[model samples]
Target: MASSGFCSLGPTVTSLFSSHALARWRSSSISPPPLRISRALSAATTVPISSSFTWDDVIETGREEYTPHNSSDLTGFLEKVNRCNRASEKLAEFIPFVIEEQIVGYIHKGFTEYLREFHDIFTFSQNGSCPDRVDGFVTLNLMLEKPEDRTRAVADVIKILGDKGIIPGIRNELYPVKPSFNAPVFFSLERAAAPYFGIKGYGVHMNGYVERDGQKFLWIGKRSLSKSTYPGMLDHLVAGGLPHGISCGENLEKECEEEAGISKAIAYRAIAVGAVSYMDIDQYCFKRDVLFCYDLELPEDFVPKNQDGEVESFKLIPVAQVANVIRKTSFFKANCSLVIIDFLFRHGYLLISPTISLSKETSYLRLYIPDFNALTLKNLLVLDLVMMII
Candidate 1:
């Protein structure tokens, strides 16, 4: 659980006017963008957690567990519910709190079921306040799905959270399973960039947070990206995630070409790859096992033509213009809109900086590199320079 503060910093652009290169992104270009924004704001921090404990073990202690592809997992889950009520009965303190229990106790005193719940408590609780009262327990969404293969369920949860922010942005939600995974063995098979410690393989992605006329426009998607767990459905502005790694730099070029419809030149022109968020999509929250954010910017007129039907349409909405629309919009489908927005607002491109404009600024940065004037024969990271270490 973390704070909801959106920010980003990458190549900046000033002009919001149309560009010749961006002619194909209008409503008449192809089909309209069909994405919606997500409303959930609490950041879902996917820490590595394991819920390998079983019902038997939980009954002994106040803990629960779920094993992948196991029938007993369900029985154990139910037992947790029973235990919640038992906890209330056993303790005279903190009994029958929250709206649900209050109503339940009033309606039926001898309850047959337990409303067991789990939450990742934040320093400041869900309402953004450190609870002055220790007697009250927090309530969260039940979020249940019909029985399915463990892998399938995990994917569904990822889609659900990504598309609709089903998981609260900053709240502590229960981890039904432990978080763990082997980095795809295939990842280490790549050959290029291997000299740069652990660069056996690499992946690529882009984060497009745009602003127009002093108002930020979060491009959203209405359709679930194709080849995704939720196949052909509504989702976030940045729908793509965790692409397979190809050659060291080749993967980024391919992803931008395929997903964002940007030329390789433009992709190179606007690369801002960096580590942004901590995620455990595989076991903790669901979807691609892990992902890091990359930032990309272009002329305001740049419109993406999704080739694979992954993105149905795009909607450009005002930045501060979010509330019910986040939940209501289909484009901000990746439940991470708040996360994305927080990142953008905090570290997003500096369009109108202290003195410079975005394009001119980018031009300067592209041509300039850290000076080689430093007295260093051992500076190995200095690109394009062959220095002899004495």
Candidate 2:
């Protein structure tokens, strides 16, 4: 599972003038007004947005001039990868959340104080000496052994917490709780509280692109400013959390139609390319997410319209320009950065030498299927190696 950070760099502008304009300005007896120079300077600098930078505004300013080739900007890409994986030092603050002797999540020592209030639902065990070690584990009451019972008991506690604003933005959607993706569901947890409980979450993110005149253009969505999270940021054409009771493919197809108005016929064409994982700790939230990635090629004539109001607008941007926007600005939602980077690697747009040394500070891992047609098996292997190094 991977996470991300948000950064925004303001607009950039580059100015060119005909000899006539230059001569006119030079010959002017009156000084060129200060406002004109100020406006010109503003146009030359990138305009930053609330969550990210605008691609079209920055692209025209020749922001990519620093690294003409996208492949040569590994350092910028690494910055993005680093933002998604953070706060490893705080891992000791959390204890395992176990069910049936199998650990399913982590609970922060601070947040566990709330769980202590619900003795009927949670049981705490002390098994180690060190205070900061994973010396203790939290479990469901043994009497509530059945999945249904456990789920209800947990749901009641979540409601109390939600009322207290401890767990804000409760989506009412259910997310499965288990040891792994394929494991049988032990119970279901409210989607918003999953992070607070340190539960491993999953989501699907798809890159919708069009191959036009030998160049690839990606459909990028501008998230609605009213969104609870990452409002007004750039996002993939389609993305959503992996709610309970749905396969990844099915979830992606549903999200594709809802988020971008793509029909099932086109959504089904999305190839499951790979997955990215990361663990992030911020205060009481321990976000461990694994995002399944997909790439769908759309017809040149297709223009996406959001059926759901989650998206405010959409634009088709050249893949190379998109790479610049990501590397140079924090306009894309952080987790979306990982998926797009994976897309770049698969499409031969990102070139990283195997011998390049990765510092220990970077924490991210990507697993790929060897046979994905988006790239040759060997290329995927090499790309996986590069991701592993980071």
Q: lDDT per residue, candidate 2, 1-390, as tens digits?
A: 111111111111111112233344334344222110010000012223356455566456324533234244355566666666556667767887889987788889999999999998899999743223437888899999899988899999999999999999988999999877667899999999999888888888999999988988899999998898899898999999999998777888899889999998888777666567666678999888877778889999999999879998998888888888776777888889778887877676664444333333334344433333323223222122343212
Among all windows of 10 consecutive residues in model 2, the one with the lowest summed lDDT is: 35-44
Off by over 4 Å in 2: 1-49, 52-73, 128-134, 356-359, 370-384, 387-390
* Total backbone clashes of candidate 1, pairs 3 or more residues apart or in separate chains: 53
lDDT by residue (tens digit), candidate 1, 222-272:
453343333443334343332232232355566567655767776665333
Clashes of each: 53, 17
The top-ranked prediction according to TM-score is 2
Off by over 4 Å in 1: 1-205, 224-228, 231-249, 277-289, 322-335, 347-390
Q: CA lDDT, every prediction?
A: 0.29, 0.70
Q: Per-prediction TM-score, please?
A: 0.35, 0.80
